[model samples]
Target: MLSWVPLLTVALLCWIFSAGQPYGLPIAVWAEDSSSLARQLVRMLDATPGLSVRAQLLSRAEAQQALQRMDVYGVVHIPPHFARDVQRGGAASVTLLHNAQLSTASSLVQRDVRQVVGTLSAGVEMQAMAKRGTPAQALQVRLEPIRTQLVALFNVSTNYEQFLAATLLPALLHILAMTAGAWSVGRELRDGTLGQWLGAPAGEAQAPARPSAAQVLAALLGKLALPLVSLWLCGMAGLVYLSQLRGWAVAGSLAWIALGLLLLIAVSLAAGALLAAGTLSLRQAMSGAGLLSAPAFAFSGVGFPLLAMSGSARTWAEAMPYTHYARLQIEQWQMGAPPAQSLPVIAVLLLATLVLLALATAALLRAWARPQDWGKR
Candidate 1:
């Protein structure tokens, strides 16, 4: 029972963190000269659910200073002629100074500000049309000369959970598979039983029976079997249980997701085998796996766009197995992309697994031939 505490604790924390999405954030408003229309705009901004007019600044300098101090995420600046321009039926503009360092929060603030400005502009236009004897029924149509409706395909509500959970959960499972596979080899070496485990003679015999390449590969695969199976189970749970609970899109067939999960596990296992064979020590193997897998979540393009990354960074991200897996999940679940789109991603994963497996097998065979290399580190 005590052993279950850490696992339960992790599950609890993930649940708590993901339960509520924060859409509304406080913002500062600075309207120069404080005209009636400016005040009305501020009120409208305050009423918006995405933003709260927490502070009314008298000067731009004060707003800038507050932003610098991190006291506010963004500042809305209404110019001196803002009201006069509106009343005269002239074009008016409001500038938003936002903290680009916090991309997500800044985006929310920008969206809310745009919505408020559009509403105010439409109202001013409708009043102007009324003065020209436009009928009341025509006024509404004139206010919105053109109407546009936005429909999000996969995530209807654009929920954060849908975006975050799908990527994060799979990445977490991949890390666990890597750790477990690495630990299996490390434990045998640390216990001074690796030679016996590999069926190779310890020291003494000049030409001890060296295991064939096939045998070496089999040994590594045997160690990985359980971890791979466990990872598959975890993948199924995320698809059937977590997806249903969170209302995440699962447009692709379950068979495709399962196949992708298998490839993901195979990649992790092959990576772990290569690390163990190269390092030849339990501690070093685990350390190497940690270094390789820790940044997978960020590089998977979950929080940011891959196109924005530099060439070198993008190349590195593409090499990660999780990056391919995440892309497949998004296409299948969210976009409901056709098989033509998804098959390429699955093919890439399969190719990676084969390459890594070959490398790991060769490394293990070399380690088996040279008994002195056992626990070399």
Candidate 2:
């Protein structure tokens, strides 16, 4: 297992950074009073790499309008007293409002906004200390960090590499495991092996018989577990390695990885069982598995902003369980959401998996009992 780690790591690395594109995070800024400090902040962001000032709104209403229309992914509004408060050695409120639909953009914009705000606030304090004839070191001591309240409704930093790398594990694992398991069901019935198992008598020394339903379900789940664990560990570790190399701070706990793994396993089993129940051919099952990637990647908002999506698109996104799971994974991993916050996300995913599993299991049992119906007359 350890020997395979390096090879797996390299594969993940290649997949993640292969895409070459600038971080095109769109942002809108509104300064209530048009203060010099606020204007400076906008200029700084425009000059900053990885960030783009898509538009500048003059009023709070304008900002809200842009957000509702999704003209921008995120908004940064500086209060009228922003400069005055800073100059007076008092704290000022700068509202950072974002469309709940664009969670990823929310985090990215907030992070960069804080960096810009911190630099500006520090400059203000340094000037005040200079007026007091304080040393440069004293100026540093007097500079207080500006607090930013971030509300991410959707992918929050748009860190393409981390997002792509982390999700690749579950996505690939599900495809491989589910496709194989689904194909196996059709193979057993087609090969007449299922009848052989049913006809075999229990030996006198044999222990109490295992429930056929339980055995089949367990076997399917067991087969998926190995790949599930491998993918989870490799993916998380790979992401951590990437973050370290890029000097990015991952905010979520390792516990979230455990939750993510369990969710992936459940999803894989459920999807596999569903495909098996349909008696899909091996090629068809594999094709179905491959089809999952397009929607999974899209609804997860890896490249696009969810806020920018229309209501119809949003409805479609909500239907995909992988979409929410991927979003939660990214939130916990890249955006620094704590375990407590991530628990609800895990709960929802578990509930969805359980529901799907129950329906799939019933369908499988019916399909198994009536294999002839699976074929066209």
Candidate with maximal lDDT: 1
Off by over 4 Å in 1: 1-21, 33-36, 80-85, 140-151, 200-208, 281-284, 298-315, 338-341
Root-mean-square deviation of Cα positions for candidate 1 versus the true structure, in angstroms: 3.7
Q: List the residue pairs that clash in candidate 2.
A: 103-153, 103-154, 103-156, 104-154, 104-155, 104-156, 251-336
**lDDT tens digits, residue span 1-377, model 1:** 11233234335535754754665588998888478888899999999988888898988789989899988889999998888888887888899999998988888888888989989888888878888999999988767779899877667766666677656767877777777767877776666566677765565322367777777778777878877876767666666654676556478765677788889878987887788876778788889889888899888888768889999999999989999998888888877777678898889889988888788778766665665655544
* Candidate 2 C-alpha lDDT tens digits along 1-377: 32275346547654656452346577787877677777888898777665788987888789889889888877888778787787777888777787766666677677777888778766776787798898876566556445459886434554465556657655554455455445555454455444333333443222134336665555555655665566556555655655566544556765676576668656765676576556434455556756764456666565577778899987787766666777777777666777777777788778877776666656555655653544321
State in Å the error of residue 275, model 2.
1.3
TM-score for candidate 1, please give it.
Answer: 0.83
Among all windows of ten consecutive residues in candidate 2, which has the lowest summed lDDT? 198-207
lDDT of candidate model 1 versus the reference:
0.77
lDDT of each: 0.77, 0.63
Taking every candidate in turn, the Cα RMSD to the unseen true structure, in Å, is: 3.7, 10.9
- Residue 74's C-alpha lDDT in candidate 1? 91
- Candidate no. 2 TM-score: 0.53
